[model samples]
Target: MKKIIFILSFLFGFTSLYSQKLSSNNSKAIKNFNEAIKLYENYNYLDAINKFKKAINIDPLFIEAYILTAQVYSDLNMFDSSIVYYKKTVEIDQDFFPNAYMFIAKFSYMTGKYEEAVKYQELYYNHYKLNPTQRARAKIDLNIYYDALELYKNPVPFKPINLGPNINSIYSEYSPALTIDDSTIIFTRKVPVKDKAMEQEDFYQSKKLPNGNWELAMPLLGELNTPNNEGAHTISADGKILYFTACNRSDGQGSCDIYRSYKIGNTWTKAENVKELNSVSWDSQPTLSADGKTIYFASARNGNMDIYVAHMQKNAKWSHPQPLPDNINTARSELTPFIHPDGKTLFFASDGHGGMGGYDIFYTKKINDTLWTTPQNIGYPINTHKDDAFLFVNASGKYAFFASEIENGYGAYDIYMFEFPKNIITTPVTYFKGIVVDIDDNKPIIHAIAELFSLKDASIAGKAITDIDGSFLLPLPAGEIYALNISAKNYLFYSEHIELIEAYDSLDPFVKYIYLRPIKKDQIMVLNNILFDFDQATLKPESYVELEKLYNFLVDNPNLVIEIGGHTDSIGTKDYNLILSEKRAKAVYDYLISRNINPQRLRYKGYGDTMPIADNSTEEGRKLNRRTEIKILYNN
Candidate 1:
């Protein structure tokens, strides 16, 4: 009997210990085969292969010689040659090596022979009864082979353009995070450590030029980059706050922990460990919601890697991390979760979910706060047998950025962008970007808070603070009405409605140059969000959102007395409009009093159609005329 060994991947292995009668009776062939085993064990693959060939040539029916030769080729990663020798063994004796079929299937799939891979996988199952794990893997491989075949026939349009030399280098680059406007990009680059044989990960950034080219990338400016490893991060929509992963630092709660940094006036503050969101297990690869209130990341706290989410609390601390639903996280590993700016679709990479193979990118839609639709594979060539991960789609849902090693890439894992496939794009998102200036002085209002409220439940959809330049940006998901309120100390809060419920160009965003009025007498501000039923004094349910804002404003400035004035369109009689407007104004006044505002501080009046901000001759003008306003009466 001749001993033969064939080592496949860690998932499978095979060895021949059969007691069948010798197929080769030649003494010279037997001697050559024995000598070949020594060279193979010493890792002299080519020499061993030559000796195995001599044995096969001397005795054409030598099954052992053919099997060993095939194993050598397989170990050398020469799948084509391995397949040839393995097939020779099969031809020489069909029952000699049953495991040969599985190897053939694996190598065939590796070499892009999907149809052949499927055939051999099916043949392997017919010949052998596998253990549970092997059986599971066999089924997954079959699904992958079949899916790959179909995908090859009908490929999605994918032309990945490299981000160019300015943003890439001769070292690995990945984990790209972009600002809402796509004007700035920050990513991780792995560079060789001086005087060391290892690489270190650090943050790098580049700004998009007016001509659409990227400026030369430089190490991100701040104390955020340290001697320790830092990578796998996400940026807030405004590009002011950055959340990233750092490992083995003294402050880390886990082997890898998430940290945060702030970009203030082109200089990033020192990173601080986000201890509330960290566990005593390895955690990395964070993605944040557009609001910067919710976060998703990969953690190995439960043994196998899974995606976990945490929310920012009202007290400005992170909530305890919770694992995502089982549909998104399987017993197998999942990683690189990216929540789109729309805040409805979540993209991640999972090996547990059956797909082409390895970690395939999958997307699941957020149905609500606690539920998500079952994940769907983003589909074929975009996800191949290799571990494809770290995908990011822009707000317009037209282009995606990822990192991959290409034939002519600058180096390992260079960043690339591709036109997002239409079939898999999430709902397009738009952002509200503007500067908040003092209405009187025209100076930027720094550190002002902007809160966006959803009209459906009046929930805080997003929040941002104005930069030193008085600029702010926040994402708006499609097809929803939003109320934006911007406020600063000793200043009347700015309020407006953003109606995106109807279809419009999502790429064209809302740009408002907000002017915050100073708190003084005669400073009148329209309450655009306050609404009433047609031809009636009853306030609509949606009106309570603005009413709450009024109550809070009054509470914040206890000594201020204001008049809630209402007006109506010109179609009605003056008496009818005046009476209806008076009741509407009283509705706001009574509601504030009900919420603890002193009645002495409140007054109500109706100006009928006397104060028309626009032409009441047209419907648009009439709509603008039918509004409520807050007029400052006293500030003592």
Candidate 2:
């Protein structure tokens, strides 16, 4: 309405300057034009349009009448008709209203006439003398038209498959979030309230069957789904924690604010407002990283909606939210930011970055802590004339899920799945899924911390905590070797090296059953992540991460005495293997002592091939046999 008022006032200002010349010579045409203006002011747009057309019929060259009719059609969202009348005014006198060319270009683009839009936009830019701000905006529009034309000519492969009736209905369903494994999907469903004109939004979830079909979706259980609106959510990689948007509740700080909930067993806990993220203005559409340590969401605290980010603090509270750089957010609304499991690529929706029309989906890469790459439109068709948002890419980077109101859909906005072009994804990702258990009774070990470290820089890649069932998932980014360390209180830590340097697929993930032995006398555990050069005892630099973990374990258990044991495979002579193993054991013993583990409490031993855990006939068995082990000699 504001835009319409502005357009009407601007047109009136221009026409008033040439009222004598632009007006029709026929008094009947002038009378109809005045009556049309009165009808438009009364909000009778259809009647006003008819009156403007009557004025145009009375005097075929009445430029003001033609302009008014086009404006009315535009307000009615009849862009094709709007373009026709605007073009008629142009045919009469193109110089009468220079801004008319701009409108025609915009309407053409909105109606998907890309080439025509580009032509009129170029004429508008070349003929008009615009101020700096106006010129910049016009340039942006021109670029958008060109880009839309290019993409329209070369479309990406996009076939959106609906999630089906089990997860969708006659009601609108959108804002879909998926677990890392793609085993579950949670989305917002807009359902009509009983006997009311208003609709209510609630969270719904569906689990995938072994046959790869989704089970019937049901409203999330527990106090999480209240009568108040709940929508636009994100689930943790493991699907145990949920961060979502809720509005008009007693606990809200704004009309709409972000809320968080936890799933325990089969029920979700009551949602609590994320006060740190909420403001007096609207804040919503939260997305969590794979590690659940960072969040990206949209907020209108500074007026127009922009993407904001906050990191989870050590105290478990979120840090103060900060908006993304201007390169990503503009003077217009930006919403529904989804950070991929890779922790770098971010997909969002923005109107500020000009594209086809309305909001278009864009993606950017996080270059560093303070910088991000410029956002790029994902392309046409995937991003149409209508608003396109809420893109959720699965961990594999192979497919994405979004909502659309398309032909044959079961709902107004049904969740749809589409594959991503491999070229568009900057980095692929996979998850490390496994269970941790006690070695003695084989019982699940809850609250064990699983941390992944990039072997290149030894920086932390991702982390996860074992659930009640001892299940955990850690995101492993592509193109790196990672060392995984799992530790729990009162238990020996476990370590293993995961190689993902080659192309990795999410469908084939790294799965393991970790057995954590209780710290006790004579308990021996292999330090699987410890590395050395062939036939050399000197520790490689890659061994430091695991070595640090081992050092921490010894420091935490100061009263225990341990022996470092090194074993050899059956490929070498017993005499040579014994000497080599002894030297390797001594090397670990010396390193631990140098790190302040009391030498008096440490011992070194060579097991050679005498204590092979696996048959040393194959390479896998031989690799398992040649290992470094830590055995508790005495526990006080």
Off-target runs (Cα >4 Å) in candidate 1 are 1-22, 35-54, 76-78, 127-140, 194-198, 503-506
Clashes of each: 0, 0
Task: Let me know the TM-score candidate 1 reaches against the reference structure.
Answer: 0.92
Global lDDT of model 2:
0.87
* TM-scores, one per candidate: 0.92, 0.93
Estimate every model's Cα lDDT from 0 to 1.
0.87, 0.87
At residue 115, candidate 1 shows an lDDT of 82
Question: RMSDs, each prediction?
Answer: 3.0, 2.7
What is the lDDT for 430 in model 2? 80
- List residue ranges in candidate 2 displaced over 4 A: 1-9, 12-21, 128-137, 555-559, 570-573, 615-618
**Model 1: worst 10 consecutive residues (lDDT sum):** 2-11
